[model samples]
Target: MNAPAYENGRLALMLNEPRLPTIGRFWPEFAERSDKEGWQASRLLGALLEHELAERAKRRIERHRTESHLDPTKTLATFDFGMVPMVSKAHVTALATGESWLEKGATILLFGPLRAGKSHLGSAIGHALIDAGYRVLFTRTSELVQKLQAARQSLQLPSALAKLDRFDLIILDDLSYARKDQAETSVLFELIAERYERKSLLITANQPFSGWNDVFPDPGMTVAAIDGLVHHSTIFELYVESYRRRKASDKQSAPATITMEARQL
Candidate 1:
């Protein structure tokens, strides 16, 4: 091959070998613009590196968000703080940063009745943390427990738990659904114990600590699990009426109110 063709081949090989695909794909356009604009070498190199870094960050966040399995519609922006006056918006905003609490591997517990937005709040926090560059996994409590139990039967429980360590936070939605069985609760306890002070957990449950005995079956295991989770935890109790219930009531009343207004007219 000619000198220019050989040089181009070498450049392609170098970019591909290092897996700098973003820079490789965009650098040519950047070079064309730079030459036309009389840009210095350092300025062109800096712009390319910055663009590559930004693209990598964007891709990383998107990949993590997909793996997190968070509800796309539930976010801090969509949550109505007015309905739940007790939950401090400012406090939640701080937690979303994933700095002090997440770094210490703390737990965040959300307790409320059904349809009270516990899952949405937990998921919103998960999404925020993921945006802040933390890995998060959102899963139903029963599903994860069953998975862990199966791994235990296959004697791959340790490996399974180790795989979860990559996530900075794990959001266990609907913790009240995990069966009150020894096998199921045992694995759940093991997971809690494993992540204790090592990785964060965000759990949304219908029942409070007092009712967790219905989930653990064994008193000792219940205490142990609660102990680990509550040690370095931030707990939120949502005391508002069910969001779905309220919305349904509003819809039911709207027609009645309209009918009364029509009669008055």
Candidate 2:
């Protein structure tokens, strides 16, 4: 075969291989650059391999983010840290990196009243973790509880919980919604037990531990669940007025403020 035919054959073979698609797609352009620049063989090979590695990393991060179910709009940049002065921005920023805590399978618990941005903060951390190459899943606590209950009914509870092990962290949004149901709470406790010390959970709840009896109903279960979660956990209590209420107040004053400004003009 001629030189061109031989090169084409190699490219075709690479394209057929599962792992070489990125390299195959970009090799021709890289080869052209190599020829034009009079690059050494090692330089061309290193450049092509580096490009493939970077593209692979990007694709992996995107796939994990999609599977995470994190809200694209709720990110660290969009979170108003000033609103919740108690929750330090620097602390949150460090946690978002998923460095030591994730490796230790520690839990992150956010306690705050409704509309205080607990879910938003949890989701923002999840997004940041995903960008740092950690797998995460964000779901409403009630929804995930329902799914687990169904899995239990179908004799697939273990399987369902096992499937969740793929994620490095699971964010359970609005834990209060699943309160006072024995069946739901049972499965939730089971999940907490299963992942105890083995994986991480990020839970957002409106109620504190003192009020968890309303959620678990069974005191023993409540204590056990709390023990499992809190043993290796970081808790943040956000005592702030509701963001929705603040917005409404601002909105109500806008028209009057506009009128006053018009009078001044």
Q: Candidate 2 has what TM-score? A: 0.90
Q: lDDT by residue for model 1 over 22-85, one digit each (tens)?
A: 8888888898899899999899999888988999999999999999999999999988787788
Instruction: State every prediction's TM-score relative to the real structure.
Output: 0.89, 0.90
**Evaluated with lDDT, which candidate comes out highest?**
1
Point to the candidate with the largest TM-score: 2
Clashing pairs in 2: none
Query: lDDT of all the models against the reference?
Result: 0.91, 0.91
Instruction: Please give the lDDT score for candidate 1.
Output: 0.91
lDDT of 2 by residue, 80-192 (tens): 88788899999999999999998888999999999998988999999999999999999999899999999999999999999999999999999888874798789999999
